[model samples]
Target: MSKDEMADFLRRRRDALSPDQVPATVTHPPGRRARRTPGLRREEVAAAAGVSVSYYERLEQARAPRPSPQVLAALGTALRLTAAEREHLARLAGQVPLGTNAVREPVSADAHRLLDRLGPIPAYLVDERQDIVAWNGAAVVLIIDFGLLPAKERNAVRLALRLRDTLCSAPAGAQGEFIRQSAAQLRAAGARYPADRVLGELVNEFAAHSPDFAASWRDHDVRPLPMLRKHLRHPELGELELERQTLLLPGTDLQLVMYTPDPGSPSAAALARAETHSR
Candidate 1:
């Protein structure tokens, strides 16, 4: 909650917005000076936000004292901030400390029983950070060869991004799309638990390694898991189409993801054959 850090963040946010995003019209007059600033001028933003230009400047400079909630809201609106950005701004302004431990600890016995009950479906539990906290036997068969992957890289998102490159000859586009979706999930989780180091590192690594991931992360698209049809070529099973569903484990920051084959499809038949082989 450092004021300097807040000021820096605000300035970066302001600089990131294009002039067109603001209300002002851009025009060039003959023999007149062209605008030299990168983003909307501070005065224009102050005017739109209904604050004194000097005060706004000082706030951006970290010289003004803490901003009031009303002022924060006005600024947020003027800047067209997203919900996540608005929350970050609120935390920075000392309006409230961001909550922590959103992922419930020591997942209850009942939850474990529920996961066990989901037998025969490729079901697994993931913490808010996307770590594989637990999984049913069927899950191991449908997804990665979990026994082969190292312990540290067992995270679903990480495996989808990094291991896919090595383990599967997936098309670049499919792999890229998978990384994009995983990054979006990570970002949504991040908005809720900003201080989670593991989440932050996963985001950084994916953004660094994948252009699609970096772009999607910047777009700030947050979506809970919708049914996703994945095209996968399993070494043992050949090819299969699977639908993935993510279910929230109530009272915990955990998700239960299960993969099922579409009914009446060859992929469904293949899954049945694979299940038999697994047993």
Candidate 2:
């Protein structure tokens, strides 16, 4: 592994994180501590990773030739690296390749039709970049209005960032969790496709659009969908409790994300209202 590449990667990851993501900090959770530099201080990262400040500094400075497996693991945990990211780190550190494949999947026509048939079910398909390749009418109603957005902005990640202020309509905890998950999943994709310039561009775009995104991206919290429960509140629809599921199309990278309401639940009742409001 080239020391230069390693240094660049380490510095980029370090700069992306905020003080909250680092455990050794003077501030409280979800609260910002004013600092001259963005991301966790080097000493904070060193403390959290269980390494000496000098050692971590050398790694970032390319003075330390190579890090041991144990040190790598410690850094991964401290940085909240996703599986993909950890694997990428290992590869960069002269370890085995994890063989990630997530790009180049094409959406099928059958999948589009299937989404149409699932009436009142909020569903959409996202590629590796989390772009909204296909979304049903119900998805537009309950989840987001894909139709109203610029095609390029038809992305779940972008929606979460661009509409961050309004997204707090859901319980604060749930909203925070979803944002964290979206950031994690996107980072996972970045690890798998490290050379994808578009991913880097999107990351930059996110940084510009949302203040909270860059920090969450560093936390590396990966949660692939099919989440057990998701509760969201709309300006007009009131409250919604939806269970989300992901069905991956075999032999492809595209994923079908569909929401289902519990039988006799309030969300089930909200379906009719969602339909009316959407129309």
Candidate 3:
């Protein structure tokens, strides 16, 4: 177990929280001195985690022994960690199995063939981190043109947070929901691959610049990508409504996302028109 990294993670998570966020069950000293740091005191965390103050202090100071699984679970609850965060904590403490950290598999040949055969449907592939790996032509025409973007800028979360004005054309509520889900997915990916420096940098960048993303991330919501309706406006096609479906390629972390228009709906006609226009 890397005590130093674990200690740093614990310290950062603690510092990020405000006093008001702590549970009501945690109480302060009857005549507490004025606090210097804004976050919870060591005693407060200890009280909430059901650990001794000295033990928690040793943990934060990186002087403690390897924490037991029970201790880790208690600490996770005390710190209000998400499911992903709790699992990450266990992995860091050497209590859980650690898989290939930060290593992403390439898109399989079968996935590439499927993408090709799904002609005129807006379909694309994204890695666990939501980075665009490959996209079909229909995705380029309907969604943001992935082919035109630099590889670094092709991430779904980054585009939603940083370039929403240019890439999003949905109602305010739909847009908000989309962004929230993106942030939550990114948070899950961060926990799953804690050693992924690129994911770390992307999170830092989004949290630094996007208040909406930062707030959603802090809520610790871990939601699977759901099949949902998306309202989009195209310069050429006017307004279109489509349903987005997510398909996980078996044995891989890649997600195949496809947008489909309901049969016989106006959206279908619009897509047909778009397809013909490209010919």
Candidate 4:
């Protein structure tokens, strides 16, 4: 099923609960008005999932990142979801177990330190599936601030392919090439971890929604991480031509990407000017 199906199914499940079954329904803030909406409110589910209210809403909207297994378990318990309902929730969230040895590595401390030291350079980290795991302040200001995005929107693949991120709006072959690389990386992940529910859901969603991605897959293109040049047109910074470098972190599936302007290029001046305006 598509993310649309997942969203609708989650809404229906949330509505099925009686008012008494939810904690928020039972305990009201002093002298607050009775809840106007029927069924468990969004806050109720978020509290149960141990995530922020906005994050949970994004999940229902299918715009956030997939929840981890622990968060899913909390959500299942909070919603009073049965065993079958839990399985359905897993499928909807794109968080079904990958396999027996499936393990998600945390962003290493060294990765964090490296990004921090790459001053004035826009750098961010991505997982094997293109999930934006970590990013620096420069990354946020230069890029689209993936930190502020909903969990589901944190994936580079989703943002570039489906969500129409501004970075991809540049008039260059870079975005098109990125799409092809994305397809190849996804294919690699699927081969290595066939039971990865997250990858499965992502591929299904892309196959249904993105014609370019579908075409890339149909062509069976594969490319390794290479030093590629990208041009970006920012509303605030004008034209930027930067060299993209990908460094694979040892002992993890994470890759650090840094965008550096060539010396004496117009992009260098633009980046310097934009730095003053950056967060």
Best by lDDT: 3
Clashing residue pairs, backbone N/CA/C < 3 A, model 3: none
Better of 1 and 4 by TM-score: 1
> For residues 77-136, what per-residue lDDT tens digits would candidate 1 score against the true structure?
877787767766777677876655464587678877877676556777788777887776
What are the per-residue Cα lDDT tens digits for candidate 2 across 1-279? 546656666777777777776544432335655578777666677888889999999888888867889989998888777676677677667665433445564567898899988888888998877788998888887767787878898887788666656644355566566666667666666665667777778888876765566767654444464574677766666777877777767776677888899988888888866766766
Error of 3 at 127 (Å): 1.0
Quote the positional error of residue 180 for candidate 3 in Å: 1.6
Off by over 4 Å in 3: 1-94, 99-101
Model 4 per-residue lDDT tens digits across residues 114-145? 98888778889888778889988777767787
Writing each residue's lDDT as its tens digit, candidate 3 over 15-58 gives 76787787655745567776688878778889989999999989
Candidate 1 vs candidate 3: the TM-score winner is 3
Question: Which candidate would rank higher by lDDT, 3 or 4?
Answer: 3
TM-score of each: 0.67, 0.65, 0.68, 0.60
Q: How should the candidates be ordered by TM-score, best one leading?
A: 3, 1, 2, 4
Runs off by more than 4 Å, candidate 2: 1-88, 91-105, 165-168, 222-228, 246-250, 272-279
Better of 3 and 4 by TM-score: 3
Candidate 3 lDDT:
0.78
Kindly report which residue pairs in candidate 1 clash with one another. none
lDDT over C-alpha atoms for residue 245 of model 3: 83
